[model samples]
Target chain A: MFDAEKFIDQQVKKVRDEVEGRAIIAASGGVDSTVCAAIVSRAIGDRLLAVYVDTGFMRKGETANVDKMLGRLGVNHMVVDASDEYFDALKGVTDPERKRKVIGEKFIRVFEREAKKFDAGYLVQGTIAPDWIESGGGLRDTIKSHHNVGGLPADMHLKLVEPLRDLYKDEVRKVARALKIEVAEKQPFPGPALAIRVMGEPTRESVAIVREACAVTEDEIEKAAAAGEMKLPWQYFAVLLPVRSVGVQGDIRAYGFTIAVRAVDSVDAMSAVYSKIPHDVLERISTRITNTMKEKVNRVVYDITDKPPATIEWE
Target chain B: MVIDNGGQWTHREWRVLRDLGAESEIVPNTTPLENIKADGLVLSGGSPRVGLNAEAMGKCGEYIDKSGVPVIGICAGHQFMAAHLGGKAGPSKVPEFGKTLVSIDDEDDLFKGLPPTIVAWESHNDEVTELPPDFVPLAHSDNCAIQAMKHKTKPLYGLQFHPEVEHTDNGYEMFQAFIDVCQAHKKE
Candidate 1:
């Protein structure tokens, strides 16, 4: 049996012993990061500073919700509206690895700046096992460049402390439950944010298009699950592909981007089978996405590919 | 023990065995049978490109031929098993992937306590098209005909769907049944 309580007790002691002084943590408000923040806060008390960066690539309403969450937790935190910075850094970058490395280096520079302000020698992140595994080390094949693991700079200034390094996504959720964290049930969001979901170049306009598509995907999927039409998928979202197709919008020829909606069921993210979302729910999601963003997106399709061939996020 | 056939869930299969209180380890498929002294073997699921790399998966074929121990092949491993044993397997007519409802055709020791029908998790581009002689069909889905099969006289089984995944409701039950089969053979 996996004991979350025992794991929590040991991790807190480990964090307290490892983090000698003040530490700055990158709080993304996802289940992993939130649970990690809660655990680290219990260890260092007031010595921890939670920093959330609004990287413009975030999902709809992500920034505001995370801000409120930090305040409720009563953790000393700061919200850095670095959307412009991220957008500037990602300009004209299309290669997946380049995008991840750019974002990773940018994050470290931002944290190094904060680390100086707080005189914090440690930098905390919610990097779990999948982060490193998929990021691929010596013998492993690189699945995708996870920003936290793959994007990390070669010479980072601050010492890194990851409390949830060894745990899987499910284990992180258990820790969140054990600590009474409210965002325990929240679905996972990639560290690279919506950047990886945008198949090609991630521009300012491209980000806006995906943000709305993701919102619609979540709304329709969640509503259907609540209505008891189908069981909720472990993770569900929309990916805005760079490819465009011809479509008929009220008999007029329209050329627009295509959105690929994906959902999967998994205990740990190591392997996942595609979610068997009801056709009716998928139709609703398609109709809402194409109709709402008809000018920008006209074709909506569901990604039926499994994890072995297709990763959750399209890069 | 889990045979690492370059599959994504090879580790998960090992984890499931350990969780089920069975001694297990993920050994590469190329490991000699005598080296491990295992009671049974689990051939893990692999990539979408199953038929493309017969050379990479050739060792599994060798193991299935040489090792007479109780063996459970999963997904790509299942496809390879059928093909290796004079059966036919290729690109699935429907190319089934993701969650698909499977119906048990014949309840056997492999699917001992499982329900007649299950919402099993599936992820495969290729499937078993023809069963080898003496291999009996155990279960099937709408998209694919041979969802599962087992050797009539030998402790050999194959499953197209991933039983180690969390989505499968009776995943643990099936693993327990396989372990019991292994335990029985180990005693013999």
Candidate 2:
């Protein structure tokens, strides 16, 4: 039998010894990072510093939510107002790899500066098994690089310590639940945040458009799930496509970008099946995204393609 | 902020700018330049050498002539800057790509806090062979002699090699120097 408790206990011990001194963690308030932060805080106590960089690529209310979650976890944390910096860094970048690499390097640089301020030597990440696996080093074909893994620069200064590096999403959540973390049931969010979700160059305006769209998707889907309309999928969000389309809004011709709502069920990030969202729920999502971001996003789309044929993220 | 030209090191340039404590943003070549607001501007390197209609190029010219913000053009941007300033730029005699050594001609604000004859990431088919009479060469590689140049008096500069990529050992230092120039200009 695969004993999750035993595994978590052993992993916690290993992390405790590995991160011998003061360490700084990139806490994104996601289940993985939240769980990792909890385990590491239990192991290292006050020696761990949880640093959250508000890259302005976060989902709607994400920064506030993260602050609340971190407060609840009783983890020592600091939030840096790096939205302007991130928006600036991502300006004019269109390629997915380049965006990931830039975001990854920017993360390290920010963490490095924070680490210096905190006088910490170790950098803790919520990197899971699939991150490195998909980031592709050896014989593995290059899947997309996870900003936390493959996007790392070769000349990184701080030493890395990833506690959840070997666990999958399900396993990490299990550990989170075991540790009594509040976000144990929370959906997964990529470390690169909305930057990758926004195709082409991730400008602040584009990111804002996607953020509202994603929030609407999540809200409607969750409302549908809660009302017993359908089962909530493991992951669901909106992707802002690079191309623009013509549409009618209140009998007026409008040309704006299309927003793709994707919901998927998966055990690990290696593969996923598209969620069979109820048509009414999808309707609500489509209606909400267009209504909320009517100016920027005029068209709403539902991604029915499964993982084998298509990845959750269009990029 | 730096603009990605679809080249590999555009992201690195963005990171360097952020690291130097300057707020940055990346806009696509198609993004209207008027929408971007920064104390200064950095034109990052990339492939498919910047086109004349590239919204960024038009904006760069506008910023230099009107905005009066300090601007640093890298590779494609350098070519565009030269072309915009009435200088001629096209294909180089020999294309320079990958690691190449560069020699600094004289101590300038751009090369501040960096060693001479430094290695930088070079990936471009086009090079600025001639400079506008108002601009002067500051650094050069053997194949592409006009590796780095700046306006004789204006707060404008250009580099043929990518200082954002790791191939350039002192690339970050160069960025830091540029940011310093911007800061000085802000004070002025």
Candidate 3:
């Protein structure tokens, strides 16, 4: 068990002592970022500026929801509407590595501009241990390029300060709960957001399909957990496959994209076993997905592959 | 000490020990047995090939053969441990990749005070079909027969399922058991 209070106090002082000047942090409202925001706020209350960028790739109503969260925490925050910027940069990009890199570069540019406005000299991120481990270095193999680690720009101007870099997803949640943050149990969302969830070139249409499928998946899964049908997974989401499959819809041959619902249980993000969701709960997710997005997504599949062969994220 | 077989929960195993007040580090199997100095050794789970790849497993064989330290092999590490000891293991006919109910067929120091049946977490394509010489079976799941095994006299053990993961009930207790075994040997 992690002594979260001791860890928090040590980290608060560490961040305070390390950062000589004002710092700007990327606050994505996920557990990692939100926890980091809360901790840094405790360290240097007014000096820390939490920047929540509204990338068009975010989940539905995320920016607005996060805005309310930051308000409750009493942290000084700035919201940047850079969805247009991200869309332009990610045009014609299909490769997972390329997408992450583009998003990272775009984020840095936005953060750099915001840092200038706040006169902040350091950039703090909620980057945990798994972000860099899977990102690969030394003898480690690169599973995937996490936007924060693999996607960082070479010529970044601001100095970096990552307090939570050594902790894992589970430990971060413990700290979040210790700090009384509401998003403590929030599922792990990639820094690149829904862009990676859409395997192919993330267009407006493709992203829209995944966004809704993901919403339905979460809705059904949460309902199942609430009703005592099944335990909640550590992380669960819907991934939009690059290829389409053939299916019949009311006597008409309909070809639509396939959505793979991935849920896994893990103490940390390093390795995970696929969650054994009840058959009834799976049927509900499949039915609701096909019914809601009838034209866009006709086929619903469950990813039973574990983390070794297949990462939590499909990409 | 934890042998890094490139397993995903290699860190978690180490964390469990650290949280339990055990001093441990994730050391690669390539490190010579003489270079390793520790009370216990945790052989961690790794890639699909670790179940079959010798080079990927590095010098794990020598460590188990040379060192008399108490060892607990998990997942791929468990498969390799069986294979090194003249047991048979290959692609499982009914591969288990998620949480499964495991029944403790026999009890020893490892399963002390634990329930007879446990919901253990597993993620592997291969399973140990036979036990090595003198290593008796301790646990079994619906799909895998050699879910847990113990060497007759030595302080060596293997777990087909991953106890380092959260889903497995009594995971921490098992680690503490192995840790206690190591502590006893340290005094010996």
Candidate 4:
């Protein structure tokens, strides 16, 4: 029912009118932000700059994949390696909301520096309906502090230009398709990235473990879906839990952290049902994770909880 | 008009109305009854548990009593409707969230042409415990007894589960049915 073409035309005009000079968009290469970058780029042409910050918390190959994707899109984009700064800012931060806020502030600082060079006063974000809805302000209960919305620092300077604020993920995908963006159907990834995937303090070791486990989970699930063994879930990934348990490997006592494999089915992110991944697929994922990580990850559990009781992401 | 009570799905309700070709806007529950101009009204579910905190509902009771239009209450709004109309609402012994099996007890205007058993999405900490004097229960689920209800005389309805969400079966049909009710009422 959403008129993607009409929506794009209207948004481009709106952005052109609202933006006086140059603008910098926080492009994450996800469906929302990518679509947003394309829309803003069409409006202001070369005046618009897309800044992609590598938070060091991205999934394996994520930074490079995004870099190439942005280049092909023909958008004026730059990749900033703020990994060290992000890691330092998030050091010792364990609370989920606190971590999101820290990442959000860190992102703004990076964007601010880039904006200074570009002389851009306006910042565009691909914040969709669920991001602000779950972020909770006024009457709505705080479900999670999304890094883009609730995680925003009050002292932020740049004027925000959220073009897709009212639209949902499905609607955004429709727009992405209309625009022929490649990652239109990409799985939803939180702005906090791999930092939130780690339950406790996201040290280098924890981040690396979760990143590998996540890659393995994604690889197995995608293969199972492609092979017709199971239906592809709306979103799927792995979370590194801090709880460590004892196990035996090669007749040696092994103690290691746990990984949780999460997947769900939903049109919008508001409500979701746990994906009915076949036991075979789940078993494969579990074995692959434990085997790949060896003694570092002795246990891999499947999260069956729905969004009401449990959000899709562990954090 | 969709009266927003801060429910997460409040915007979803508005989106459903728009998809169904109804000119709808989300208004805060605090809006005065006279300021509302629409053929029908929907009181959206909110984080405020009506059973525990009624004052936070913000003149929703006034809208139900004074607004002359078809009204549908959802979740918190449903609880508040029952409470304001001399019924009872409280914390559910078994609170349901996410996917639920809702069985229609009556083919009311809202559930017209829908299957007997439907999949509905629920996210509620409290529920209507007792039916208001002039109201009858329309549906139920395993954990919650009164999933849906309607007034005997007034064009009033209530739903504990969310039909505006895409996960819910026949959500568009249910909303279309409500729109029909509103249109029919406007004709009279």
Candidate 5:
């Protein structure tokens, strides 16, 4: 029932009216932000600068891929490699909310520096409905402090602007299609990125293991979906759990970590059901992960829990 | 009017109404009774456990008592409705989440066009345990006894599962049926 063309026209006008001068958008190269960047660019033209920050917690090759993506969109953009700062700030931080808050504050600090050079006063985010709803405040209970909303510091210099605040992920995708953006159907990724995917301490070693496992999980799922073996899940990835299990690798006693393969089907990120990936596809994913990372990951299990019992991403 | 009790799907309820071509807005449950102007009202679910704390539900009790419109309660809202009306609501022995199969027992005004059994999405820590006087059970799931209920005379309804969410089967039609109920109540 949502009219994308009408929504786009109204949003462009609203952005033009609200933003008097220059603005810098936190473009994550995801559907919401990229679509946001496109709309903001249309409104402010060259006055809008798309700032993509690589927090060292992104997916494999995510930073470079986003870099090329922004170039193609023809939006004035820059990539800030704040990986070291993120890694350092997140050291010894284990709480899920704490990680989101820390990453949020760190993102603002990076954006502040960028804004000073670009002379921008407005900070545009691709924050959709679920981000704030799940974040919780006032009467609502805090489900999780999303990096964009509840994780935001109380005191910040930039005036916030979110064009997609009321819309959900599916609605955002509709807008993305209307705008003809390349990442229209991309899976929703948290702003905290791979940091939340790794449970407990997100040290360099843990992050690397999860990243590799995630890559393998994604590869196998995508391949199986392409081959018509299974429908592509709304979102799919691997989670690195802290608990260790014993296993036999190449006839040697190998003690290693476990990787949880998560895939869900949902219209919006608010509620989700575990994806019914075919047994053959799941076996392929499990075999590939254990074989590819035999030294570090010994066990791989699929997450069957739903949203109420378990969220999409593990802390 | 979609009364906001701070539930996650509260906005989804509002969106459903808007999509159905109804001019609807999400009014806080705390709002004064007189300020609300609508042909019907929807009591939204909340994060706070209605079974444990009813005060967190704000002025929802007042809205149900005096709003004088067709009303539908969901999740926590549904639980609060039964409790406020002298029924019983508490933590479910087997709380349901995500996917659930709800069997319609009455097919009241809200479930007019819906099938006897529907795949309803649910996320409730608490549920209506006992039927309030004059209220009849309309639906039930395997775990919970009262999945749906309706008043014998008044235009009131409650659903344990979320019909506003996309994953729910016939969610849109259910909303349209509610809209029809609201319209019929407005005429009366």
Candidate 6:
């Protein structure tokens, strides 16, 4: 009874009307945002500006990766080096909500500035159903504030437009597939990026530590998945806890912060079960995180907490 | 001791306390009064408007009444102290959300080396309009009348402003005063 083609066509048409003139879409190089950019490109053609803000909290080579992917999609895009701005804004602010809000507002401010440069009136986001649902509106307790949803400021100037607002993660993947976006099977990344993954104040140094750890986690997990050891997870990353603990590194007492690897499989982000990553893969990730950043991070741990008791993000 | 009122400030306060050379741990609001054992207690700011079934308020009141230890309450903790001692906490005429300055009323152990007026971060909808019989108002601000208060005879203190926040001027000094109180109590 699920008609994928019909739904895509109808949704595309609806969004086309919703975003009439010039608009800018947030394309993070992830499947959801990429797919959204593609759909909006088809709807308004040159009127859609895909703006990507490099928050400096992203994973390794994320900015270049996004640039290449957006180029391949033939979407009109601009990459803003807002890393210094993001770093300056987040300095000495440790609260998770504050971080998310700052990042969210920063993202909007970046896009808004880009929109001004392009004379665009609409801001397109890849926000889905679970974002607003979990963010909690009327009669709903806030589970967590999604940077794209609840974290947005009340007085944002741009006219809002979310084409994929009602769709789930899987549904967005389907749309991505229908649109032939290469990142259709890509794992979900939080809109706030690596800022939320760092438990305390998200400084450039802390983000660097988490970025490398996250890379190692993804590489090890993917290697295991490729070897048919386990199914690829829906989403996975590494979190850097603020506290430093005592640990031994190569017969020396090494005191460093702990890195937590989180992987989960889910149809919708509303609920998720922890991925059963093999012991070998976890070992590889732990070894790589510690070996790569021995001075900054000496201990590595895997998070097995489910969605109900714990959110996907440690923050 | 870090009072975990299930707010973002609870964790930050613990981090700051730990950074200041104090071994701190976050205990849930439901933790019993008898189980708490620390050199001092921090009444962290949180959304105390959420149901009081956690009994954190009751336990905190009992701890302050019996422990005779140095206690520093921030924001909601400040309101809780006022409410516990038969003072009133009504809605603020103008809620302070970000940065504001508090004028110190008298030279006390709390504001020992600090200036007469210090900038501090504030985020609360409720504030104490009146103090208990034995409570002394040590500071005041434009919107918040009782910016700081302390028990006349006890080592207990309360602050309407968040000293843990970096925006607060002389926040670290305020924290140092609380730690000094803790140290002084230990010596006694």
Using lDDT as the measure, which candidate wins?
4
* Model 2 stretches with alpha carbons more than 4 Å out: B1-188
Model 4 chain A weakest lDDT span, ten residues long: A306-315
Clashing pairs in 6: none
Off by over 4 Å in 1: A14-23, A95-98, A112-123, A129-142, A153-168, A216-312, B1-3, B18-41, B47-71, B76-95, B100-106, B116-119, B125-157, B185-188
For candidate 6, write residues A70-166 as lDDT tens digits.
9989999989888899999999999888888888888888888889989989998988866775676532356678889987888888998887776
Q: What is the lDDT of residue A154 in candidate 3?
A: 95
Q: What is the C-alpha lDDT of each candidate?
A: 0.85, 0.80, 0.87, 0.91, 0.90, 0.80
Per-residue CA lDDT of model 3 for B1-188, tens digit only, reads 89988765677788888888888788887998888998888888876657677678888888888887898889878888999999988899898866689999987999999999998877788888889999999999878889999999999999988887766899899999998899898899
lDDT of 6 at A158: 92
Structural similarity to truth (TM-score) of each candidate: 0.76, 0.62, 0.82, 0.98, 0.98, 0.63
**Residue A283 displacement in candidate 5 (angstroms):** 1.9
For each model in turn, which proportion of the native inter-chain contacts is also found?
Answer: 0.16, 0.00, 0.13, 0.71, 0.51, 0.00
Q: Write the per-residue lDDT of candidate 4 for residues A7-65, one digit (tens) a residue.
A: 99999999999999999999999999999999999999999999999999999999999
**What is the DockQ (computed on Cα atoms) for candidate 2?**
0.01
Off by over 4 Å in 4: B48-51
- Model 1, range A1-315, lDDT digits (tens) per residue? 467999899989999988898999988998888888888999999999999988889998889999999999888899888888999988899999899889888888888998899999999999987787677653345777688889888899899999888678888888889888889999888878898889778888998999999999999999999999999998999988888999999999999999999998877887677899989999999999989999999999988877655677776
All DockQ scores: 0.18, 0.01, 0.21, 0.76, 0.68, 0.01
Q: Which is superior by TM-score, 1 or 4?
A: 4
TM-score of chain A of 1: 0.98
Q: Backbone clashes per model, in order?
A: 0, 12, 1, 0, 0, 0
What is the TM-score of each candidate's chain B when compared with the real chain B?
0.95, 0.91, 0.97, 0.97, 0.97, 0.92
Distance from true location, Cα of A269 in model 5, Å = 1.3
Superior by TM-score: candidate 5 or candidate 6: 5
